[model samples]
Target: MSDISDFLNHLPADRARTAFDLVHYMLGKALKSEDADEVLTEMAERIGRAGVPLDRATSIVPLLHAEAVASARFWERGSGARSYLFPYTPESGDGYAHSPAAVVHETGEWVRLWLPETPDDTYGIVPELKEAGYTDYLMAPVFMKSGMAGTFSFATRAPNGFSDEDLAFLRLVFPALAGAQDILATTRAMQEVMRMYVGAEPQRRILSGDVHRGEVMRIRSAILFADMRRFTELTVDMSAEEATQLLNAYYDCIVPPIEEAGGEVLKFIGDGILAIFRAEGAGNVACFKAIQAAQEGLDRVAHRNGSPSFDVGIALHLGEVAYGNVGSGLRLDYTVIGRDVNLAARVAGLCGTLGEPLLVSDTFRGRIADAGKKTSGGPVSVWSVGVHALKGLHTPLEVFAVAVP
Candidate 1:
């Protein structure tokens, strides 16, 4: 035992191998003395795979199995018994039999309890514990941000069960497990934040025409173009920082509804946002969502800046066009490129030309009407381009506008 102690006392000869050996020994140790060691092992493996620190990971489990094993090899003259880690509960004997410990739900907090020994306690013991000739248990709880994540329980076959030293060690290890839970929570939160922006890259490349996807596959979709009205003039009077801050605030107001409606914002060129609603896949639901998103965006922007009003012009077009990843392999963007796309943009630009807040192409109006929906928001009208020939189009298109409601 002293020799083993001496070997571990010095710096590890091989870091990776030492870490591996440490974990293996710990698992074996957990298995030997504890009847419920397998559960702890599963937890340890999960934490390890997540790249959590061993100390932090251990803090979350029944016991830091690895640490227990090392301590056993050093302090206990004889070795090879595993440690059992579980939360303490009243039904099981304080000595060691924590019955029904396997399925007990826990809050993410450490709790200590003394189990009262009784013949009636038989029902609570995990069936496997009885099969393994075990009869007593002790345990502790590990907490997480959401709630009690799990428990660590220890069991023994001895009638007299665990001692003061056993309970003390487990209590000492509880803090470590809690730390690991916090680390995992923070890691997950950061990952979720990253996922939001990272997924948009592929679509960005497709829209930018940096990457090609075997020629553009034309499909019917709802095209949306929104631009901040008089943005150039508005920003010219403000400082760069103020301008940037206002733009960001405006984006914050606009983005929520778009994302909520399952629309993808492809690009933000200057003060305009080009969004696409993949209508074919989600059907009318997608179209409605896009419209809802636009409405929400308008409302949010209006509320964000009150009194001295800031207005946005939006145009929607429903049409078939070449849409997909179109560009060199170096870069690509998932976007639509065709007469319909152009028409939508032209309509958006026309919002400024007509001094209207919202405008929609006849194509968009026709689709919504076919779906049994009425077009609202035009009590206050603007120059309605009744029917005019749009450049590069085979036929004339009708356009209308409404005030910034």
Candidate 2:
């Protein structure tokens, strides 16, 4: 026998039998030239009677992930996130055998072999399965930029059990498994984005020429509204080209601070921006982040103008808002709505009336204090516009302001 064949031949009766069973199982399930050739005459007859085409990767990958997950349950069911356990790395100075080579190989690859017990038998592709309380294991990688993704891993409880032949067979199977998984993930994400921009799902089914829309999700957040104090009048004096250049310069100065403050610029209305803060953890974090972000915006524009020419009014408020697809499906605007949103706009509007460049709603201000932030001032208000009703709102809101802080 050849070296590879000889290695296979040495397997014990049971292992050898299982190995053959595995080969046959894969051959029958996964279409291949070799398998089809063996039953050519039978295949022809079967095809003549009834034909079945294989489904594409999109349908198949979910099934494969499910199968791997089911198999992992044989070892231990109900483990939170990770169903399959890997070879445990020993603590320093512990009795468990620590092999750097094995550790490096497992960490670097798209596939890994977990032998939980064998501390020393880590050199081979299949780690010492018996010592690690693992009989057979198959691992597939999930490439996600953040946290964990789909991991298809299975394990058995047997000794020196999963041999070279079994390992080689799995290696061949893994590529197809990984590819199908990747295709499904990419397709699902793209489909979600497509659904967002195309409006109705039916519209997306028909159009293939347009840009795939980005998915937007609603979340409770702090809203920041900033506008040029005198943009409408200031631009009238400048030439069209000069106005455009100035606007672009202003955007450059303002955008970075919002981003640095963990805000997404939801819209650029003429010479203003509406940004949402969704990066804060909880509590009044969102409001505090908006305050810091507004400060950053002021500093950036101040530096850019040298003589502080570009005057910007910033306002912040906290409330739940309808924060998803805003524009036509063809051109999306991911923005926010509701009382907090209106309040932010009103606060921005007040920058002119109050003669202060920064203003934050009492709700936003209260949240900042509730989050343990120390600030000096209370109800230093010029207007108590008794619950002035906004255009879209049902109830008039009780609005107050601290023009400067």
Candidate 3:
């Protein structure tokens, strides 16, 4: 490892001051920009303007997200900036382990190699870049106070490769770039976590400072309530890991179709899922979307069933709901609460007793009729299942069962 002090000692005072001023300006601009791509583009421009013969620059930052482990790459070739997300899995570990960025990450130090002189077996990526006409390559780790480390790799096609002065100047300005990266990474992580737990719109609303308990908004929506049939009995004898896997499989079947139909899954209540499709203008578009999602869910569940079948019971209702934050001061949940939400849940409970896979409220059926929107399943028949007293209600509630042909 080369001593950082050696590089610092050789840096001229005038050059050092210029680097400092440039980094200061970059950091100030980064603080004001929320877009990561813009920040990276500006950094690349600044580096090129500093008299370095830069051909390409790449930044690899780890992120917190489902299906992705630790790397998102930003590449700048000339003036254009592009980014790619690398999803990590156990099967993909080998490729990352052998990468040059991995060496910098593991050592927590700089990995500088003269591409023209590097041996074929020295590293996995260097030989390729050398063949592509790169003379110098440097990979450095960017450490943040948050303990997350990112990487910056600079490449040049300049015949003589990077000078000691160029490396020294980079060492001085890297901390400022890393600081700005930390801020962006933190914000992105928070957004990812919030969107994963709560629905997307709810996450945005909560982040925008709508946190007071009992603060509610009345909006019309097509509500869906779905639960796995006999989930308790099925999981009673299974191990904890087995139960979790079973639940995830059920969600895999339930979530995608709803999301594909432009519905937001609000919450998971044990084995049950609550989702909504909010309509922007007139017409029963929300109702149409909810029914389409329910049909897709039924089809997916049927396809997922094996020798011993796993089934689901789904109910759809359309009405106004109170969407907001509700709970104690210390603990709060952002979800929907209203009579319509309760009625949807109660309707879902009747699926097993009524011997039907899917049910819809009379109000929902009326909205479909009023809007003249045909079911996506193409001319399916529906039958009135007689008004019956729901558990918590005094008045008899009429329900309809969709007969899939």
The root-mean-square deviation over C-alpha atoms between each candidate and the true structure, in angstroms, is: 15.2, 15.3, 2.8
Q: How accurate is candidate 3 locally (lDDT)?
A: 0.80
Q: Candidate 2: which stretches are off by over 4 Å? A: 1-217, 279-282, 306-308, 326-335, 372-405
Better by lDDT, candidate 2 or 1:
1
In candidate 3, which residue ranges exceed 4 Å CA deviation?
A: 1-21, 281-283, 305-308, 370-380
Ranking 1 against 3 by lDDT, winner = 3
Q: Taking the tens digit of each residue's C-alpha lDDT, what string does model 2 give over 332-366?
A: 64444566677778768767765667776656766
lDDT per residue, candidate 3, 1-405, as tens digits? Answer: 155566568678776676777678677977788666777777777777667677878877777788786655555465577777778677766766777777887888789888877887777786778777988999988776667777888989999988878877787787787777777777777898899888787888889998898888777789999999999899889989988889888888889989999998988999999998986565387887788788888888888854336889999998777777878877998887889899999999999989899899998887666453455444445789878788877777999998643
Model 2, 381: alpha-carbon shift in Å? 13
| Native-to-model Cα distance after best TM-score fit, residue 207 in candidate 3, in Å | 1.0
Error of 2 at 356 (Å): 1.6
Estimate TM-scores for all models.
0.49, 0.42, 0.90
Clash count of each predicted structure: 45, 8, 0
Ranking by TM-score: 3, 1, 2
lDDT of 1 by residue, 203-293 (tens): 4443345454655666577878888887877778898988887777777878768888788776677787878787774345445555667
Clash pairs, model 3 backbone: none
